[model samples]
Target: MAPDDERLLKLLTTAIVNHPRATMKDLAVLAGVSKATLNRHYGTRANLEYQLEAHAKGVLAQITRTAELHSAEPLHALQYLIKEHLTHRDMLALLLFENRPKTPPLENEESYAKDLDAFFLRGQHLGVFRIDISAAAFTELFINLVYGMVDAERRGRAASSRSASTLVQIFLHGSVASAASNLPE
Candidate 1:
C-alpha cells in the first residue's frame, strides 16, 4: 500500500479505537478525511473494515517475522513475541474495540500459526514447553493467553505495565516442561 493509504488506515484505526461506535462519516472525519474520499477509496464501510483486518494481519506477520521465532531460542523468542504484540499500540487498541467486524482471531491465521506451531514444537523438544499437549495446542494457548492479557488490562483486571511479563509467566507456568516448571518464580 502507498504511504498515504497506510496513513489513512492508521488514522482510521485510531478513530475506531477512540470511537468504537462511530459511523463511517464520523470515522472519516476523525481520521482527517472526508466521507466522500473514504467512500471513493474503500468503496464501502465493510471494505474499509476488511482493510483494517488485512492491515492487522500484516502487522502481526511482520512482528512474527522480525522476531525470527523459528531460529531463536524458544523461550527468548516467545518473550519477544509477547512483548512486541503487547506494545503494538494500534493492535492493542483494535483488540480493545468491541465493535470491529468479524475478523478471525490471530491464532487461526495459518501463516503465523504454522510458525508458532514449529516454535512450540522446538520448545517442547528443548524441554522448555510441555510435551503432554500437541504443539498446535501450545500455539493456540499462547495466542489466547496473549489476547486474554490484553483484555484483562483493558478491563482493569490487570496492570498494563507488567502485562507482558505477566503473560509470559502465565503462559509458561501452565505450558512449561515439568522440570523447567521447578525454577524460581
Candidate 2:
C-alpha cells in the first residue's frame, strides 16, 4: 500500500476504534484532511467502508495462508487464524461493525467467503469437520461465532470465558473423530 493509503487506513481505523459510530467527517478530521479530500480518495462513505473491508480481508487472507503453511491440519490453520484475529481485537471490532452497513457487499467479501469455504471443504475432506454440513454453512457458522466472541469482548463482558482455542473446540466437539473413528487415514 502507498504511504497515504496506509495513513488513511490508520486514521479511519483509529476513528472507528474511538467511536462506536464513526462518520466520514470523523475520519476526515482524523486524517488531517478535508472531507472533500477524503471523498476524493474513497468516493463515498460506502466506498470508504469497502476499502476498509478489502484491507481487513487482505489481512485475514494473508494470516490464513501463513497458518496453512505451518500447520499440519486445516483445523489447526483455522485455529491460528482465529487466535491472530482475537489478538487484533480493535481492528476486528472495526471490521465487524463496518460490515453491517446497508451497502452492497464488496468484491473482497465474495473472495473471502470463497477462501473460507475452501478451508472448510479441506477440513471436511480430512474428516476433521462434520461432512454433513455444506461448506458455505460451515464457513458462515465459524465466521459468525468468531465475530460474536469479538463483539462480546468489545462489550467488556466475560470474553475471556471462551478463548479462540475454546471456541474451536466447541465448534468441532460433535464432529471430531471418536475412539472408533480415530483410525489413521
Candidate 3:
C-alpha cells in the first residue's frame, strides 16, 4: 500500500476504535479528513468497513510472521503470540471487540486462516496442545482470553488481573496437553 493509504488506514482504525458506530462524517472528522475525502476514498460505509477488516487481517498476518508461528516450535510461537497480543492491546480491541465480523476477507486474505489452522494442527500433532478441541475453537479461546485481559486493562477494571502472564497462564493451562497444562505461567 502507498504511504497515503497506510496513513488513512491508521487514522481510520483509530477513529473506529474510539467510536465504533461513528458515521462517515464522524469518521472523517476523527480521522482528520473531510467528508468529501472520506467519500472519495471509501465510496460507502461498506467499503470502509471492508478495508478495516482487511487491515485487521493484515495485522494478524504480521503478528503471525513476527511470531514465526509456522516455522518455530509451537510452544514458543504460542507464547510469543500471547505476549505480542498483550503488547498490541489496541489492535486486539479493534480486532476482537470493536470490529464486528460483518465483512469477510478478500480472496488474498484467506491464507491467514489456513495458516493458523495448520499451525494449531501441528501443535496438536506434537502434543503441545490439547487434541480434545478443534483447532478453530482452540484458537478462538486463546483470542477470547487475550481480549478479556485487554478489555479489562483498557477499562481500568483490574491491575494484576489484566497482565499478559495471567492470560498466558489461564489460556495455556486450558489449551495445552494434559501434563503440560499444569505448566502455565
Candidate 4:
C-alpha cells in the first residue's frame, strides 16, 4: 500500500475502533476525508471490512513475531504475547465486533490460531497450563479472556497492564487465587 493509503487505513482503523456502528460516510468524516476518498481507496463497505481485517491480521502477525513464541519459557511467552496483544486492544475489538468477510482473512482460520495453539500446547506439555483442557480449548479460553480484559479496560474497570496480569493468572491457575497453591513451589 502507498503511504497515503496506509494513512487512510490508520484513520479508518481508529474510526472503526471508536464508532463501530458508524456508516462509511461517518467513517470518512471521522477520518477527516471525503467519502469519495474512502471509496477511491476501499471501493465499498465490504472492501473496507476486508482491508480492516487484513490490517488487523497484519498487526497480530507482527505481535506474534515479536512475542518469540518458540522461546523456552512457556508462561513467559504467553505473558509476552498478552502484553503485545494489549497494545492492539482497539484493533482486536474492531475485529471482534465488525462484520467479517465470509471467506475470512488470509483464507484460513489458523492465521489467528496457529501461533496461539502452539504456545498453549507447549504450556500444557510443560505443566504450566492444564493438560485436561485441549490446546484448542485452552487457546479459545485465552482468547476470550484477552477479549474480556480488553473490554474491562474499555469500561475503566482496570488498567490494561493489570488486565494482562489478571488474564495470565486466571489462565494458568483458575479464578481462585488459592486453587494452585498446592503445586510444587
Candidate 5:
C-alpha cells in the first residue's frame, strides 16, 4: 500500500474498531488529513468501502495461505486461521461490517472462501471431513460459528481462550465429521 493509502486505512480501521459509528469526517480527523485529501484518496464512501473490502479479503487470504504452508493437516490449518482471527478481533470486527451495505459476490471477493473450500475437499478426501456437505456450506458453517464466538467475546459473554477453543472443537466435530462420537476424546 502507498504511504497515504496506508495512513488512511489505519485511520479508518482504528475508527471503526474504536467507535462503531465512525464517519468519514472522524476518519479524516483521526488520520490528520483534510476531508478533501480523504475524498481525493478514496473518491467516495463507496470507493473507500470497496478498497477496505479488498484489503480485508487479501488479509484473510494471506492468513489462510500461511496456515496451509505450515500446518500438517487441514483442520490444524483452520484452527490456526481461527486463532489468528481471535487474536485480531478488533480488526476482524471492523472488516466484517465494512462494505456490508453493498456486499460483493463471494467469487468476486478475495477472501479465504475459495481456499477454505479447497481445504475442505482435501479433508473430505482424507476421511477427516464428511463428504455429505458441500464445501460452501461447510465454509459458511465455520464462518457463522467463528463470528458468533467473536460476537460473544465482544459482548463480554465469552472471555476465555478455552471457551473459544471449545467452541471450535464442538463445531469441527458436529459439522465436519460424520459422527461426533467418533472424535477423539
Candidate 6:
C-alpha cells in the first residue's frame, strides 16, 4: 500500500479503537477524509476492517523482527514481548476486540506459539518456572496478564513500573511472598 493509504488505515484504526460503534461517516471524519474518499479507498466497512487486520499483522511482524525474543533469558524475553505489545496498544485493542473463538489463527501465529513454548520450557529447565504447570498453561497465563494490563490501562488506570514488576513477579513467583525466594538459586 502507498504511504497515504497506510496512514489513512492507521487513522481509521485509531478511530475505531476510540469509538467501535462509529459509522463509516464518523470514521471518515476521524480519518480527516470525506465519506467518498473512505469509500473509494476501503470500498466498505468490511473492507476497512480487513485493512485493519492487515495492519495489525504488519505490527506483529515488526514486533517479531525487533523483539529478538531468543536473545535473553526466558523470563526477560517474555517481559520484552509484553512491553513490545503494550507499545502497540491501539492495534492490540483492535485485534482483541475483533478476536473470535472460531477465527482461524494467522499464518505466523503457530511459529509465535512455538517460540513462546520454547521460552517457557527454557524457564522450566532453569527452574525459574514450575515444571508442574504445562508450558502451554504458563503461556496462556502470560497472555492473560498482558490483556489484563492493557484493559487496566484503557480504563484510565495508568500502569506503573511497579505494576509491571508486580505482574512479572506474580507470574514468576505466584501469590506467596516467598515463593520465588524459595526456588533453587
Error of 4 at 150 (Å): 1.8
Locate the minimum summed-lDDT window of 10 residues in model 4. Answer: 103-112
Report the CA-based lDDT of candidate 4 relative to the real structure. Answer: 0.79
Taking all chains together, each candidate's TM-score versus the true structure is: 0.81, 0.69, 0.73, 0.81, 0.72, 0.78
lDDT of each model, Cα atoms only? 0.80, 0.73, 0.77, 0.79, 0.70, 0.75
lDDT digits (tens) for residues 41-93 of candidate 5: 88777777667666666666667777772335876776787787676565566
For candidate 1, the per-residue lDDT at 20 reads: 75
Q: Which pairs of residues collide in model 3?
A: none
Clashing pairs in 4: none
Model 6 stretches with alpha carbons more than 4 Å out: 1-6, 99-104, 157-163, 178-185
Show where candidate 2 strays beyond 4 Å: 22-47, 69-72, 99-101, 160-162, 174-185
Instruction: Please give the ranking of all candidate structures by lDDT, highest first, separated by commas.
Output: 1, 4, 3, 6, 2, 5
lDDT of 6 by residue, 68-139 (tens): 655677666767777777777778778777542334467766666666777788778887788989988887
lDDT string for model 1 (75-139, tens) is: 88988999888876566557545465686665435787788888889888999888989999988
Please give the RMSD of candidate 1 to the true structure: 4.4
Q: How far in Å is the alpha carbon of 74 misplaced in model 1?
A: 1.1
Write model 2 residue lDDT over 70-117, tens digit each, in one string.
335876677786888776565676777754566556665676778778
Once model 2 is optimally superposed onto the true structure by TM-score, how far is the C-alpha of residue 155 displaced, in angstroms?
A: 1.0
lDDT, residue 17, model 1:
68
Model 4 error, position 153 (Å): 2.8
